[model samples]
Target: MLGKTVKVVAKPRRGTRGAVSPRAARMVLAGAVLAGAVAGCGDEPIKMGAAAVVGDDRITTAKVDRAVLDCEKQFKADQVANQVRTALENQRQQQPTSGEPADCSARSAIDTMLNIEVAAAAAKAAGVSVSESQVDRMIGLMSQQAPAESIVVALGMPKQFTRDVARMNATQGLILQRLGADGNAQSPATLQAQQQALALFRQTAGKLDIKINPRFGSFDANRMTVTPITTRLSATESGVR
Candidate 1:
């Protein structure tokens, strides 16, 4: 059984117009890419100590742990330095008192990496690509709202993976553009386009072999998120027939 589930969606802040802000749009697109049940069983076994496997690539447990630690450290430092509070103030948003759970951080790291892989695959299939310059430009635009490091921490991402986050966002943006989002998130046409893009990503994700280690939790393909697995007693352990 699944325990606590960590779903990562960029909640809209105050003063944002449309159904989704640009930042929120990026997160939503990545998070909602695959909407269905858990990933189907695959023939190839998951590598030992892997956090998750996407096709030929392996997201190692060590990598996840390091990311989580880095995020926590950076967040703590930000709190001490008042960077988070200042950023929230600049953005006219209320501040959060506590950091997210360790499990959630791990899930986030896994999900972000998985989303990047899926986005790349989707782009390749669609004959679309986001250039490095485009990613840099997107990061620059994001930095206009707040410092990149602060934004990274605010998004629950590690500072080290800043470029990865921006690249994923840029790729999704290009995909949505190709799907005719038109920069009007609140418009029906844009919403329809987003839906179409999401469906395309879902199809792309289905064709890839994805697996999550049970220790971290199962991958919920429906939500494109990770859900914690609850330990269950066997029939003999429970004294049942």
Candidate 2:
């Protein structure tokens, strides 16, 4: 679901009572790129025990661990599990693996954190702002199709960060609209708008001086995802004969 480009659905007007179509909700939720395994690069060495560095902010491994734990706990709940199962069935998707240590992996948690940071930066660069009310409204609209927790879990995000995910979705939607994305997501105009938004994200992310620890993975600007480092050894190993 991540790392793949998808259409961005136009947000429903405020005060509208209609629910967002399931297809639209899925597209919007899955639009963000997911982390992949690849080596990362940075201008300087990352701090010890840090997962990744974004601009002046250092996301610690502890934080990622906590979020992963939260996700795991949420996945254990009968309510959450039932909601997720129903939503997946509606979408014709498979169920999550049971007994996994953590439903959200460290790599994914870090990647989601990175995406939130980058999305905020991109919004600022574009001079776009999404209010808490807007985020709530978007969530409300999505809730008609599926509960917010289900949507968050399905997207591999921590349930606690539901608002953050909603805000990012709203902000990106507005940015794309400003970039000339018509209401029709399948149109050529919308495709162009998505490309422009991607460029904006790349540009803003570049200025943030992001660096990922090798223990986890590296950030790939082209794919805008955190990828794992390869373990293949060199011809001479250790760079010396």
Candidate 3:
């Protein structure tokens, strides 16, 4: 999510594992300040080791590497050429632009993973649940729209990561279902539940003490997504619904 930045970022480069290298992390101006600046609402920042730490869970660099390899398996350079262009164009329109996008990269895949992890954590906190069967059913429904792998790639995620993300989405849906929000586009109950879920998400984020590698980016509280800390951004409290 694009939001206010304390400083604008310079151009971006792709990291081998779908993030900027630590060396590049150092190159980015104001890297140290942004590292743990927005890790928690007021709690102590998480110490970096793996890619990030969400609550008691650790999202490791090894997982990220596996995802990078999965993304490579999903599509070839020519297949996603136009889509990559469009994605970059979208990133280009950011308010305090976070620099250029990688030409032939799976970097954005990491963002999808980060968002899913945060959303899953929040959903668990909100008492949202989806059985494995429910997840499978949702997967079937979504696959009817397109191949599962293709859909994941379309969302800038690794094909191998689809099942978990699908489960997360299903859990989010369960929240709406519990509120009787499903099939009621403009229901007050739906809106209230959505609001409540967001609140829970923010609360969870506050206590999660998430620490992302400065290489990939800093978390944008407003959008609940990671933004490259190429600049000194003014991050605020936020969550992913």
Best by TM-score: 2
Ranking 1 against 3 by TM-score, winner: 1
Each model's total of backbone clashes: 1, 8, 4
Instruction: Encode model 3's per-residue lDDT on 22-141: one tens digit a residue.
Output: 222212211111112224322234444456666677666677777776666565542332243344345457533354343213235555554566567766776776788987886776
Model 1 earns a TM-score of 0.71
Q: Estimate each model's TM-score.
A: 0.71, 0.74, 0.62
Residue 90 shift from truth in candidate 3, angstroms: 8.3
Error of 3 at 78 (Å): 9.5
lDDT assessment of candidate 2: 0.62
lDDT of 3 at 218: 62
What digit string (tens of lDDT, one per residue) describes model 2 on residues 11-82? 334444333444435543442432221113584566776778887888898898898888767765524333
Model 1, span 1-241: residue lDDT tens: 0011222223335543222234432332232233223233243446676877877778898888888888878877553113333333333333232222222277767766777778788888777888899978867765653455555665556777777767766777787778777777677777887777767777787788787766666655554457665548442443321
Q: What is the descending lDDT order?
A: 2, 1, 3
TM-score of 2: 0.74
Candidate 3: where are CA atoms >4 Å away?
Answer: 1-49, 77-107, 231-241
Local error of candidate 3 at residue 144 (angstroms): 1.4
